[model samples]
Target: MVRISEFQIKDVVNVADGKKLGNISDIDINLQTGKIEAIIISGTGKILSLFGKEEETVIPWKNILKIGEDVILVRFNEKNEFHIQEEE
Candidate 1:
């Protein structure tokens, strides 16, 4: 397993079908296991900020594509990808 320190927040995620999701807001950590549970990403669109919205979508850490020192790449399930839009 890799260390969380190797990854940074606010990194962009590229999904299939050319849908570009937003950046990482925070990370979900498992307190019991002391490991990263998932990566939280902010909702799409600029309108969210105006409405005081703070919705975040969580992608399992295992689904991550790569964890770089500067950014993180993640892949979301295609079928449930639309669920992220409603959460916003």
Candidate 2:
């Protein structure tokens, strides 16, 4: 078993394209079922970051392929576009 805090420290990577998504900034959970729904990745600042226009990426739990000691590997189709939304 791993604590949620542990997830914050591990980097999240996409195995399909070998892209490093970033670390987990938050998570979505099903309170009623006590299950993890998805992992939320905080966006990296861009040139326009000064305007606070970054979007957070959400990775569904099913997309996660493996959780390792230092990284969490995920798999997504080539056409799979990450869900992005304004930070809360």
On lDDT, the candidate that comes out on top is: 2
Which residue ranges in model 2 land beyond 4 Å of their true spot? Answer: 46-49
List residue ranges in candidate 1 displaced over 4 A. Answer: 1-10, 45-52, 81-88
lDDT of 2 by residue, 1-88 (tens): 8998999999999897888988999999999998999988887864345556666788889999899999999885536657575643
Q: How does residue 81 of candidate 2 score in lDDT? A: 52
Model 1 Cα lDDT, one tens digit per residue, 33-81: 9788887776655453665545567788887887666555677775664
Error of 2 at 39 (Å): 0.4
Q: Best TM-score goes to which candidate?
A: 2
List the lowest-lDDT window of 10 residues for candidate 1: 79-88
State TM-scores per candidate. Answer: 0.61, 0.84
Pairs of residues clashing in candidate 1: none
Error of 2 at 9 (Å): 0.9
